[model samples]
Target chain A: MTASKDKEEISTYKTQPAEILAIRDLTDDTRYFKLRCKDITMNKDFQYRPGQFVIFSLPGVGEATFSLSSTPTRRDFIEFGIRKVGSFTEALFKLKKGDTIDIRGPYGDGFEMEDLRGRDLIIVSGGLGAVPLRSVLLYIEDRREEYNKVFFLNGARSPKDMLYKRDFIAMNQRQIIDTHLAVDEDDTGEWPYNVGFVTQLIPKLGELIDSENTTAIICGPPIMYKFVIQELLKLNIPKDQILMTLERRMKCGQGHCGHCAVGGRYTCLEGPVFTYYDVQHIKELI
Target chain B: MSKEKFPEFVELIKSKGKLFGPVKQKEKYSFEEIKDFSELDFDYQRTIISPKKFITPAKYSTLRFVKFGQTEVLPDDEPQIVMGVHPCDIHAIKILDRLFLGNIKDPYYAKRRENLIIIGHSCLPDDKCVCQSTGTDMVEDGFDLFLTELDDFYLLWVGSDKGLGIAIEAENLLEENVSEEEIQEYVRWQQERSSMFTTSIPSYKYLADIIHLNYDSDVWEQFGEKCLSCGTCSLVCPTCNCFHVDDKIMMNAEEGIRERMLDSCTLPYYSMVAGNHDFRPDRTARLKLYYTHKLKEYIGRWGQPSCVGCGRCIAYCPVDINVITVSNALFEEVCETQEVCDQ
Candidate 1:
């Protein structure tokens, strides 16, 4: 019943403190934080993938799972685009640079970047779903030659909720990637991009590129997936080729905690990123 | 030599480590640290809290951190023996073992789980027990010593070198060997006890199929309407392994201990994600998730169901919603519907 500590890697549930290096506000409720290792870097052994999430712990407040918004290509620091939702995030949102916060993981079996190589990538994101997808986008941007073509479709409710607005504009102007941005329920007049659902933009993918050769990835609200996936399926994208990231209250960030499980699959362990083919059997995936 | 010597055995085991097992607390039974051997009750209807609490604990600090400085993870562990654990609980421990010690090791759970000794108690079934149906009433290998209570004397199986050492230390209380006639009677007793379980699913193997086919089954909704979303069922379940971790500030306010407590899936916000995106927002979906995880999903992943036929969930649920009732309803209705489709 006893396992030797010498043989095993670092203990999986252990938490190490990380100091806040920088904080940049994206909206009234959301902020982008760049944190450097305070002591031991769990990141060294963690080998954190682009789409994986970490359990951010604020001493005296609580713990919450936040996605790694920063690309793994930048190994100097870990970054998160966190929105103040619950009390835990409210406390985290208040912290400034040089402040320390506890973190465990870089949990979840994240996106298989190797699988997307040489394939035409179509990335769709809604609201703050762009947080984790930012890691994916930036990662792919670094290895531009490895993939065929890239298309990014982003949707937000209004200018206030829009994330990475400046980056999207710059990436669109670069011409290497096709970027489409939209905002529904926008109160701000004279918006530059299309003002409708993101699903409306999928039709723009016209016969120029082959749907069979494309890998469509979606990260958005549960309500947004129905129409977006319907549009992707209409384009004849294979179920296996269409990947979607799922969100759940991941407490343990380990498989034992039933909080993050979709059906029997633990989202923290199996994925926060699961292919549509994998979720076909998994019930109540949102 | 007989039931009278049970107290002496308890004293012997208690000498080794902290003795924890089922003891009558008011009207119900629960596993607690035993100070007196006489308090140890071999017979009980069901323990309100499962033996899981002893192994994993409800709450514990995993780490400590201070302002702008070092963060230390506490890995200190203690050794203990949990005596008189029923076969069903032994089975639950096996599942927990696989989960904690498997591919991705949970150091928090592993620290306590290791250096733990379990003595199996081959118990007689009660009205609520469905371990016979689940095949968990009889465990092939989970304990060092398995004690089966006979009419007059206790039939003990020293299953390991550790068990044999304990038995040898107290050789004065035990008989050398049982007669062939007594052994046959023991086997008959096992058969008789197994026949007592009244609750059952149609078949454990078909449980996954039934759940898969009936994802939209009205039965879950029916139970969901009655469900208070209180999570009493999950709290009492031996195999329900959900938990929450948080950090608490010490009196100094400069330091804090990061702790973990058991959480529940039945909570309305269990699946709520960032930006207020809720996956299983309603009671019906949450309840569906809970049932499917036990019967279908866990079996798919772990090669075995999380349920051990202990029926602790059924017995402890305040609303009277039962897994056996729902499972039977789902299976019978789904099978009938399938038959109609075939016709």
Candidate 2:
């Protein structure tokens, strides 16, 4: 994998192979690809601010950008949790563990964790939006001492659809982090946790929301962003302090391709991670 | 320097190798080999596409990847000159130069660009063209040679040594002792013609500030309603330099070439990611991005406006979603001026 340090200086040309170390099926439609650098070990140490994405490629097929699901601290291997929604992701799902594919970038601006220091971090992720937020949560975990309190509230379509279940459960048991898992329905009764839309759990986490130094980082389907952000606002988090990641069809991770732009900002370049204050005025971004 | 004869200029270029110029094709014009000086079409507005098609072809082999124990790289291409380009298109080429040849320096575009000699054609304004507003009415320097047609004579300015060489070889067709008044008159005429060709926008400096302040303005919905999102505006635009790269291997799977092609922000799939996360998931966001980038962000960086007002985008858009019209609308709303409002 070739990781670009400066966001705008990236060229749309280069591509390098990343060997898939593991592929675990999270759900019928969602799978996790554990990738290890083949040509460049520098990418292993590739530090990306949370919410940034990497361009993953299948040679001869095509390339697609995916948010880094693993924290920057996990330098040896990067993980991508993808939902089979389109041709490229569907093709990626067909690849086996040993299969090698081209990878370019850890492109675009990721979530700004610097300002959240000494603050309560509220992570609200819906569906596969958890993929990018996963990186942020892991980053906070790596430096748990710096942060006040970290609360993770993740919502999926159903109990079966939740990702990183084992890790989430283990973390919850250790109480190293406060974790809330909400499902649209408790159909299989497999999950004995809080059940409902993720937004419902927001009101119940009183201390996490009431804290003055609270910062909410949200990523999810458009509908989820609307309701989740609405909840955060009700809790009176400053607009600038609320961070959200947007999903766009990014052909080139660089700013050159007009794709991935929300108004004047290229989501792949200027942001995938944006403060509510920055995007509040830009309509239809949700 | 001294002027050279026109016939000698043609002969000199012919001696060097093949020379290309705009040739009249039906009612339109296209870049083709020049057999004689009369075949040149100086009246053409803009080509079907910018000259970018030459450097970065719609489909060209980027590099060949062969597996001989390990992967081996091979490139495919030769160099050629592109001549008789319009001032607006020349400006577009310069934008591409900044993108493809500046920082990263794409070997493909850089090689072809180095091989090419740009001969800019002075714009004699047409109703469809607005190169003047874009500040490209007459190029100061992006070409090897620039030509302006006078009454029964062609005024040639040698911008590079290659152009001087051509002028020297074309000595027989040149006339000596041309008056300074004639050159001044030509420049004056070009300036006057340019002023008439432009479609005014608000002050370029205030563009970003205005857009940022008016982000919630209802103008976006108005423009979005009219925008077809066919991407013609960006495709024809001189400064919209976004592109996508893909790798295509032969059926044998042993070898392939990586290809980079122009991509437009207007396309829906341009921002679509693997996990179904669409950053700018709606048409309103996309339309707003195009205008702000051209009028706001680019202006913020370059000081000058990103768009050169080469009306090719206005001319080629299927739905007539001209940037001039949209910008003027925004300008009127922000400045409350009747002048831009009337446009």
Among all candidates shown, the one with the greatest lDDT? 1
Predicted complex 1: DockQ: 0.56
Tell how far residue B61 is off in model 1, in angstroms. Answer: 3.2
For model 1, residues A49-120, the per-residue Cα lDDT tens digits are: 788888876667767889888877777688888888878887787778888887876777778888889988
- Give the clashing pairs for model 1: none
Misplaced by over 4 Å in model 1 are A1-10, A39-46, A185-188, A281-283, B1-5, B64-77, B250-256, B340-343
Residue B168's lDDT in candidate 1 = 93
Model 2 root mean square deviation, Cα atoms: 4.2
Off by over 4 Å in 2: A1-12, A40-45, A112-115, A204-212, B1-4, B14-18, B35-38, B63-77, B99-108, B152-179, B191-235, B244-258, B265-293, B324-343
In order, candidate lDDTs are 0.80, 0.72
For residues B1-343, write the lDDT of model 2, one tens digit per residue: 2333555565566566557777778776667877777786667777666777666665555545655322323233443556678777877777767656654455556667776777776666677676655666667777788877665567777788877776676666666557888878787876687567545544544567767666767888788887787888877676777777777878888867666777777777666655555666567667887888777766544455567666777778886677767766677677663333232
* lDDT (Cα, tens digit) per residue for candidate 2, span A151-197: 99999878788887776777678777798888898889877898889
Per-model TM-score, in order, reads 0.92, 0.85
lDDT of predicted model 2? 0.72
How well is each residue in B1-343 modelled by candidate 1, as lDDT tens digits? 5888878877898888777878887888988888997777878757888888876778877667686554546445556788778889889989988888887677767777766778888787777888877778888776778888889888888767778889998798898978998899898998898788777755566788888888888888888898899988878888877887777888888988878878888888787866676888889898888888888878778888788988787787888776787788787777678873232
The per-prediction tally of clashing pairs is 0, 22
